[model samples]
Target: MASTSKVALITGGAAGIGYAVAAMLATKGWLVNIVDIDQEKGVVAASIGATFYKADVRDYHSLRNAFDDTMKRHSRLDFVFANAGITDPRNFYEAQTSTLPPEPSLALLDINLKGAVTCTYLAQYYFRLCKQGSQLADFDPTLVIMSSIAGLEVYSPIPLYTAAKHGLVAFARAIATPFKESDGIRVSCICPGPVFTEKRKPSDADRLDMVPMETVCNVVSELISPGGGFGRCLRVLSTGISDV
Candidate 1:
């Protein structure tokens, strides 16, 4: 075990923003358990000194098993990042036939909004367990949700993705105070503008407005710190981060 006993569980941690955060925390000696649907990334996680659990965020039971296994192994959890999400797969407005429009796929909502809600519920439950077992007078557990700039504004191209992110911000704000009072758990949402990740090539023209992966990871570090505030949606841009 590391000198610090702090532990974090992150979804979608195999790559992108989630992976960056996990790697950052691992370097800081925080025990990181990554729960991602991509099983192939398990080795990548291990390379960073983080454990990886193969589980889909949309599957409640499988996700819960990851949580259970993490707690069983580490016996403590200080942070949980609900970062799994995806963009709208098909056109919501497009009509396959002249008379009737094809049913819009809601997979985005299931993975983004619903998955986040489930993670939040499980986080609170385990946070309480950690509280009961801890000897420290002030044990604070934090939940950091991944929202997007689209959540704050209209993103016409991906309406479903925008809606899911918006729900995350609202959900975090709605439960922050209550969760803090009830479980001594702080909750906050990170709303970043388009982020530069492996999937996003630098050659793309839109890269100008994209936030760096480092910036997003740094924000996660701040949010999990002892003094990290609750209920605020911090927006990350190419330049810096600010409260939204």
Candidate 2:
């Protein structure tokens, strides 16, 4: 490992895009911490040299404990990936049925929008707190959030997922400037189109339109690099990437 290798924390890192990001960082020699609700994959994460903490992003206490454990293990935290999220197969309209009439799932909002928000808030807090004992550098630490192309444009079928992703994009943009000026913490977002992660069921057409998982990880690597800019929204497509 490099002498100056950094530490990174990724939420929902047990599988899919989160797991890919964790592996990318690990290969680069970063001390990666994987936080997710799945205990089984958490063990797999540990096997790959990442410290795994079973955490549900929706719960503040659960998240805090994970953060605390990460801090205890590592002296400093240089990057955070607020990537935990989920979507219901049923949209709001489809959820209404004459028979059992399932209540609209707040699970989407809770885990997607609110959970990302909570992770961002706590990340900033810990970044500042941990830096208090030492002099801060002009630039280094970064927060790369996982938004989606659904955030930039609307997708009607999954209204709830679209809404939550839109919230993440707005949240990243709104705080970018302030975090840069006040804390020297770079904030950026990645908006990928129809990524073929395990949680998503993509059709043939969707796969054609989808960006590669590696492409999304590269965007995050760019954001975490020292020369990276603040307030950038990177959108990935099957063709390539664009800064929006």
Q: Which candidate is the best by TM-score?
A: 1
Task: Look at candidate 2 and give me any clashing residue pairs.
Answer: none
- List model 1 lDDT by residue over 1-244, tens digit each: 2124688999999998899999999898888999999888788898998989999988999999999988888878888999998877777766476576656678899999999999999999888887785775545799999999988998888889889999999999999999989888999999998888888765853657878778888888888888888888998988778898
| Candidate 1: stretches off by over 4 Å | 1-4, 98-101
Q: Model 2 over residues 152-243: C-alpha lDDT tens digits?
A: 99888888889999999999999999998998889999888878776566464355787778888888888888887889998888988999
**Number of backbone collisions per candidate, in order?**
0, 0
The 10 consecutive residues of candidate 1 with the worst lDDT sum are 1-10
Q: Model 1, clash count? A: 0
The prediction achieving the highest lDDT against the true structure is 1
Q: Look at candidate 1 and give me any clashing residue pairs.
A: none
TM-score of each: 0.94, 0.91
